[model samples]
Target: MTIKSLGNPYDGDVDLRHGLACNCSDCADDAGHRMKAVSARDQRTRMSTDDMLDRAVESAIVRSMFGHNELSRRSFAKMLGGTTLAAALASVLPIDKVKAAILDEIGTPEKTDLSVGFVPITCATPIIMAEPLGFYQRYGLNVEVVKTAGWAVARDKSLNGEYDASHMLTPMPLAITLGAGSTATPFLMPAVENINGQAIVLHNDHRDKHEDVSTWRGLTFGVPFEYSMHNFLLRYYVAEAGLDPDRDIQIRVVPPPEMVANLRAGNIDGFLSPDPFNQRAVWEEIGFIHILTKDIWEGHPCCAFACSQAFAETYPNTYGNLLKAIIDATQYASDSANRSEIAEAIAPTNYLNQPVPVIEQVLTGRFADGLGNVRDEPNRIDFDPFPWHSMGVWILTQMKRWGYIEGDIDYAAVAEQVYLAADCGKVMADLGLEVPAETYKSHVIMGKTFDPAEPEAYVESFAIRRT
Candidate 1:
C-alpha cells in the first residue's frame, strides 16, 4: 500500500496543539525515546516505528527556549539618563552619568580605538568635538576624530572602511549606500548631528537682486562640495524660481573660507558657506549675505551619524552609544544658558578650526539670513529629526533621479537598513529621553514649514530645480 504523507505535523493541527513537533535533531536521533512516547499515547498496545515520537517534540521545545534565551540587552535606564538642566549648576556633570545610562542599555560602544572622520564645523562640527570632549569615550568608545580634506574625502574613506563612521555630508551616506558612487553598503546613520547653519554667501561686489528674484543671473557660486547636500538645495531652490540651474548659472566647488577669497579675487561670483565663514563674511564685509541654507531647505537634515554596513551589523551597541553621544550633545547645545560654552568648545583649534566669535554666531543663530531678516533667535538645528527613513527615502529619490543608482532600487527597504531608528530610540529611552516622532520631512525650521507628506511634490514644486 502507498504511504500517505503527513503535511507539516505541527502546523495548525488540533492533535498537535498540546505537543511540540519532532523537528529537533537530538529528538530525531533518539529513536528509542521516540518509540516510548509513541507507545505511551497509543490507541493500540504497539505502534509502528514510522510514527513520530513525543521525545522529538520535547527537544524542539527545548531548542526554541534555548534560542530565545540568547536575546540580550544592557539595561535601558543606564543608557538614557542625563541631567543637563538639573545638574547645570554642578562644576562637572562628568559625562559618566549619561554614559552610564547609555551603557546600561547597550553594554559597551561598538568601535573602540575608532578613527572617525569629521569635516570642518559649520553646524555639523559637534560629532567631532563630542569625542575629545570625552563624550564618546565616556560612553565606552575610544574614538579618534580624523579630519579629511573635506566631505568627499571623508565619505570615500568611510566607504573604503579607512574610517568606521563619518560625520558625512547629508547625501554621502545615502548616495554611497544606494550604490551611487560605488558599491552598495548598508550604511547606518542613527541620529541628527546639526542643521540650519549653512548659508548662501553673495559676492563682495554683486548686489543681491531680491528685486529680480526670478532672473538674478551672473552668479558663479561656490559649493562646499560638488555632491554635498548644499548642491542639492541650491539646485532645488534655483528650480523653484523657474530657472534651469544647470543651464542658467554656473556652480563651482570651493572650501568655506576660500569662498570669500574666490569672491573677493573674482574667482567665483558668489558662494554658499557655513559659519564661521558665513558669519565672518557678513561681519568682515566680504559680501552681501544672499540666503541661509536654512532659508532654502529649512529644517533640512544636514549632517547624520553614519556607520558602515559592516560596523552596524557587528557592533550595534557601539552605534547606539554614538547616537546617544550625539543626542546628549544636542541637548547641551539647545539650552540657552549653554550657548557660550558650546561656542567656545567647538571653536578651539582642536575642533572646528575657527574663532570663538565665529562659532558663537553659528551656535546662537545670530547671523543675518540675508533676506532683511537678522535672526537673533533660537537654534535652528532640529534635535529630533526623526523618521530618519523618510529623510533617506527622499534622498534616495533625488539620488535615483540624478542617476546615483542604476537599476530599480527599493528606497523604502534600503532606507530602513541605513537609519536604524529602533536602535536610536532604545538609546534615547535608556538615557531617559522621550522619543520624538520619526519624521518623514520637516517643513518649517526657524519659522519655516515644509509639506512633510509630499517631499517629492515639494522637490517638484521648485520651479528652479533641474531634472
Candidate 2:
C-alpha cells in the first residue's frame, strides 16, 4: 500500500461540547497526554506496519471533522478516550465501509514510474536521496531522480512536461504561476527540500576585501538563477552594504555545478550558490566561505519540490504518493544523525557528483572556511517540507522590490494558491509530523522584520529597491 494510506493516528475531531476556554484539571491533564503522544509519534523515523489501513480510516475521519486544527482535536481526545471516540465516530459514520473503499484505492498508482528532475546540489538532497534510500519505493513509486544541469533547464523541462516534477527554487513556482519568466502556467510547491543550504563565497584573491563590501565595487558574482534565493539574498546583502546591486556590481547566471569551475577560472569574483558548490570551492582552495546564507536569514527557504497544477490534477494518486515520498525523505534528512549517511547516498556521480567529504562538511556544518578556520554550525542547512505561505509572500515582496514583477498584486492570495501549505500540512500530519497552526507569519531577515500582512509597506521600507 502507498504511504499516504497510513494516515495520522494522533489527529481527530474535537468534542464541541467543551469550549476552548475550559481550564479544568481533567482537561488540562488530558491535553498534556495528547501533546506527549504527538511528540512521541513524531520521534519515530518511519511509519508503523501494524493497523495501517485502520489508522488511515481514523485519520481521514478526524481530519474531515477537525481540518488542520490540532488543538481542537486534542481537546476532544482529552474529553473522551480514543476507544470511546472511535466507537462514537463509528456509530455515526460507516467506518468499516469507508476503510474498505480506501483500501481498494490505496495501492493503485495512476502512474507507477516517473521522472523527477533535480539540479546536482546539496539543496536537492531529499529529492536525490529519496531514490537511493528507497523512499519512493516505500510510497509505491518508481522514481528516477534525473540530474539536470541548471534551474532554467529544469524549469523548461517542467513547463514542457519533460519532468513529472522538478526540484525548484522557492521563487520559481510563484514566478511560473505569474508568468514572470515564462508563459502563465499554474504551479504548486507543496514541499521545500532544503533551507539555508547556500553560502556566499569569495575568490581567495579577494580575501582582503571580504570584510569591506564598499571596496569591491566592480566585482562579478554568480547566482544559480535570476529567480532564486541566491540572487535575491545576494542583491539584499550587497544592497544592505550600500552597494547598488544593479549598477555597482555585476550579477551573472551560472549553474551550480559550474560555479566552482567559474570561480577557479576567475570568471566571477564570487558567488552566493548552493552547496556543496560553496564547500567545493573551499575544497579546491580557490575561494573562502565569506558567510553562510543561514547567517543572512535564518530558516529561509531555498529549494522546493514543485509540479505543474495539471500534473497533480491529472494523476491525483501518483501525485499524493510522490509528495509523501519527498516529505518522508525530507523528514529523515532533517536529523543530524542521518547527515553522513545521506551525504554518502547523494554524493555519487549520478546525483550531486561531489566528494563525500565536501558533502559531509556541508551537511554536518563542520568545515574549513578556506581562511584557516574550521567552524561548527549545525543549522547551516536543514530540510523542512512545509512550504510556508509567508515564505511565498516574502519571495513575492522581493520580486516586486527588484522589478521582476509589477502591477497590483494580492500577495496573500497568490501565496495561498501557489505554496500549497494546506496540502503539505495534510501530508505532514499523515506522517505524524507537527504542522504549524498558521500558514503566514512574520520573518526576521538580517535583523529586519518582514510582516506578511504589510508586504507593500515592507517593500516601501527597503531603501534599495526598484519599486
Indicate which candidate wins on TM-score. 2
**Number of the predicted model whose lDDT against the real structure is largest:** 2
Which segments of candidate 2 are over 4 A away from where they belong?
Answer: 1-107
Whole-model lDDT values for every prediction: 0.57, 0.82
Candidate 1 Cα misplacement greater than 4 A, ranges:
1-106, 109-111, 368-375, 385-387, 401-409, 438-467
- lDDT by residue for model 2 over 1-467, one digit each (tens)? 11322323343432221222223343355554334433345335444433433543456456456642345665776588767777777789887787666546455568766789999999998888776555665555656677799999999999999899999999999999999999999999999999999999999999899799887799999999999999999999999999989999999999988999999999999999999899889998999999999999999999999999999999998899899889988998999998887886676666776788999999999999999999999999999999989999999999999999999999999999999998899999988999999998888999988989999998999899898
What is the Cα-based TM-score of model 2? 0.79
Tell me how candidate 1 scores on lDDT: 0.57
Question: Which 10-residue window of candidate 1 scores lowest in summed lDDT?
Answer: 68-77
Candidate 1 lDDT over 1-467, as tens digits, reads 11111112222111111111332333345434334333234424322322322222222232222221111111111132223322431334443344345346446444445667877765565675464333553455545666566776777798888888888766776677666666777677777666666777775556646445455465687888755667767766665576666777788878664766777788887666666677777666767667767666656677767778788778777666666667766655556565665565455444566667766767766656444567774654434524367666666656544444555566667777776777777667766777766535445533435544555564554444333
What are the per-model C-alpha RMSD values against the true structure?
20.5, 13.6
Measured by C-alpha RMSD in angstroms, how accurate is candidate 2?
Answer: 13.6
Q: What TM-score goes with each of the models?
A: 0.71, 0.79
RMSD over all Cα atoms, model 1: 20.5
